[model samples]
Target: MENNKQPQLINPAELFNPEPYGFSHSISVKSPFQMCFISGQSGGEGENHVLTDDFKMQVQNALKNLKIVLQSHSMTFENIVKITLLIVDHNQEKLEIWVAEAKKVWKGTFLPTSTLIPVSQLALPGMLFEIDAIAVK
Candidate 1:
């Protein structure tokens, strides 16, 4: 006789150092859906878009831009399966602030896979951070 038991789903967070294995750093879902890839987004409004010279503000704006892209596809952060963050002048203090801001948006629910990278500089001056996201819908 064959048993018909479903396998337990794995949350990416439960995995250790998922990046080395080319997997998300956290959270995964079992589903058949389409994936969406968003281009790298920076924090700015227009040609004169430099709003705040602060790292925290840049991080916030980057998240806002990410949200806009997701909304355009009728999605939200909950639908995000993977994200890559690029930062210039990376520092622990900045990361801590960024994490705090992210908590406001994510609220410790539906943790998505993510990667953070430190870079020398972004394409634009006065921009401290950029983010790209992949979503399943």
Candidate 2:
């Protein structure tokens, strides 16, 4: 059975609204909840970890992978409390793309707390984006 207790998504008025950026300021999860810490996922697919050169495709696939992971744990994006995003060569264009893709994934739902870090490179070649999340159940 799904738990009745729900996490509290916070966005204090004092702080700039972060929803447009596809995240909340913070999340307060109460007791008696199970937490799942998902590993960073990239656009790599299948056991071979094949990836494409397209940034949009990479972001889309990464989100798909994350959704699959969440489903495996009997959870959804709504269960996510915190998400960390890593982007290589982050820029205005990339940021716009990320926001647009994120909105598509988290559409009509409360977004999770998030932090995005721009790095020079990632662990693997052709990896432009990576996302990790913490979910509460």
Candidate 3:
């Protein structure tokens, strides 16, 4: 089976650089034979399902959880075309942490086109970050 890869990145000179925010202006995909949309994933897990307040921890765990979901769906990071991040109390510091965690997750691999959405709050009170993904194959 051919593993669909990250979409083509589009960054027009007219638009400001989106790299700092860990996203692109747009991404175009050609062959999306199959598509999967995973809902926003949070950092909390296990029986207690206790969410962490640490932004970095939340970013890490959210990506990890997304990985597991993709695996179960027979997809890898390459198959992901886009990722949406919802950050509570978003700021430059949080964006940096998110980019750092993303580098770790997609190390030596093509980074999926991503979007970071700043919001006042999330589903849970303590949740710091939530990530949702769209994959193709």
Candidate 4:
């Protein structure tokens, strides 16, 4: 017989700039399973994929878009083990707000290892945020 239980989620509080520093807190999954690599999703829907040019709105829309992707694969944010966030202008104050909003969606349980990168610009001019994720089921 073999144990088929899911690996315990790893959390590193002081993983040396664990988040917002391009570092991962943990790698929980092993090979040999179906993997989903979601592309960097920006705020908006088809033909209306233009971000609002506002950080908060862009962040909201981006997260909504991510949800759609997750649903398409029959998975939710809980299944996500890793996430990468890209921001056009990274500000600490704005980040605080973003974190608050994230908590609402993530529920502070089963937090996925994440990274946030501050870039000068995204794929679009007005885009303020983009999120990409990887998950296994």
lDDT of each residue in 59-136, candidate 1, tens digit only? 787787677666655678888878899988899998898789889888756888999999998876777888887788
Query: How close is every model to the real structure, measured as TM-score?
Result: 0.72, 0.76, 0.73, 0.73
> Cα deviation in Å at residue 101, candidate 2?
0.8
The sequence of per-residue lDDT tens digits that candidate 4 reaches over residues 57-134 is 877877777776666656788888899988777999778868987897899568999999999988667887888899
**lDDT (Cα, tens digit) per residue for candidate 2, span 102-125:** 988787668899999999999789
lDDT of each: 0.68, 0.79, 0.73, 0.69
Q: If ranked by lDDT, best first, what sequence of candidates would result?
A: 2, 3, 4, 1
Q: Which candidate should be chosen as best, given TM-score against the real structure?
A: 2
- Ranked candidates (TM-score, high to low): 2, 4, 3, 1
Candidate 4: worst-modelled 10 consecutive residues by lDDT: 9-18
Structure candidate 1, residue pairs in collision: none
What is the alpha-carbon lDDT of model 1 when measured against the actual structure?
Answer: 0.68
Which tens-of-lDDT digit does each residue in 12-101 have in candidate 3? 343345477566533445554656666677787643457777888888877777776676556777888889999988999988998888
Give candidates' CA RMSD values in order.
11.1, 11.6, 11.9, 10.6
Better of 1 and 4 by lDDT: 4
